[model samples]
Target: MDQPWLKALHVAAVLLFAGGLLAQSLAVAAALRNDISPGVLARLRQWDQRVTVPALLTAWAFGIATALDNGWFGAGWLSAKLLLVVALTGLHGLQAGALRRLAFQAGRPPRGLGRAPAAVALALAAIAVLAVAKPF
Candidate 1:
């Protein structure tokens, strides 16, 4: 694929993945406070499985491809962006686990989990800055 097209796809996938993470963060936070119906949770899970996870994978794949094509490996900005991306990916795993536990059992999420949305937003903003500025 052309570089520009690859970049566009990567951007689109990242947007979708970020939106999914935000949605999951809100859903899990809401589940912590009250009783959301299993049916609704099920639907959200379906969306995550069908849309969110795929977007995440696509983002990763295209991102790696773009970096390799451009010889960006070992660059400071890419390294920082990669760290943030890893953190976000791990957060998604936690969110998915929380959703499952909430759907299956009656319990609250771990403390501080409610602040995930803010953390995600902060990390995402930093990632954008690093990617755009490439300041070492």
Candidate 2:
């Protein structure tokens, strides 16, 4: 409700989203060895819908509102952080689409999907540093 609480919620959501992505990525990568298992994909679907999607939405909503409320748009640090966040969000989209394909279309995850977890981890690290250091 309040700004501080909202910011806390945003952080929590980001953490949950990141953790879910890592878990899903691991599941997907493992699934590639023997084709996507229906059970695993089913679990992934539930996790994404129940946790990842909501967390992503909540993070963005609270983050955008906080930035606007504080008028930090013009700051160099904020801009850098936003850019990284955008990249991470794009990764989220890719992961979600892959999950859907595996869940519905019985698609095999491409070999390239294996690299996603690493990307997310690195992006999250960079975003954390930018947020903490606020370096230009």
Candidate 3:
């Protein structure tokens, strides 16, 4: 593929991934607010497993491809953004762990687990802004 088209697709994938995370964060908040039925929670988990996970994986794959194609390196803003992305990925794993634990516990979800989604959302928003502005 042409470099420009590849870059565009990579950016689009990143936007979709970040947007999906934000939507999931909002859904988690809503679930916490209202009484979340088991069926709804289960469906949400299923959606995350089926949709969000694969989208995120694809986004990361495309992002790496773009970076390699473009020779990404030695830029302060890009470095910062990459670090933030790593942090966001770690938070995602943490959130998944929390969800699994909650599912097994068969009790109310831990309130602290809420922080993971919120933090991931904030990080993603920051990454999006930085990507657009590229402020060092």
* Backbone collision tally, model 3: 0
Error of 2 at 110 (Å): 2.7
From the highest lDDT down, the ranking of the candidates is: 1, 2, 3
Tens digit of per-residue lDDT, candidate 2, span 1-136: 6889878888999999888888887776776676557887888889889999899888999988888877878989888888888887777777777777877766777788788778778888988898779787
Each candidate structure's TM-score, on Cα atoms with residue i matched to residue i, is: 0.94, 0.87, 0.77
Clashes of each: 0, 0, 0
Residues 16-132, candidate 1, lDDT per residue (tens digit)? 999999988888877877857778889999889999999999999999999999999999999999999999999999989888888788566886788998999999999999988
Between which residue pairs do clashes occur in model 2? none
> Scored by Cα lDDT, where does model 1 land?
0.91
Residue 87, model 3: lDDT of: 80
Give the Cα-based TM-score of candidate 2 against the true structure.
Answer: 0.87
Worst 10 residues of 2 by lDDT: 27-36
Off by over 4 Å in 3: 27-34, 106-110
lDDT of each: 0.91, 0.82, 0.68
Query: Residue 112's C-alpha lDDT in candidate 2?
Result: 84
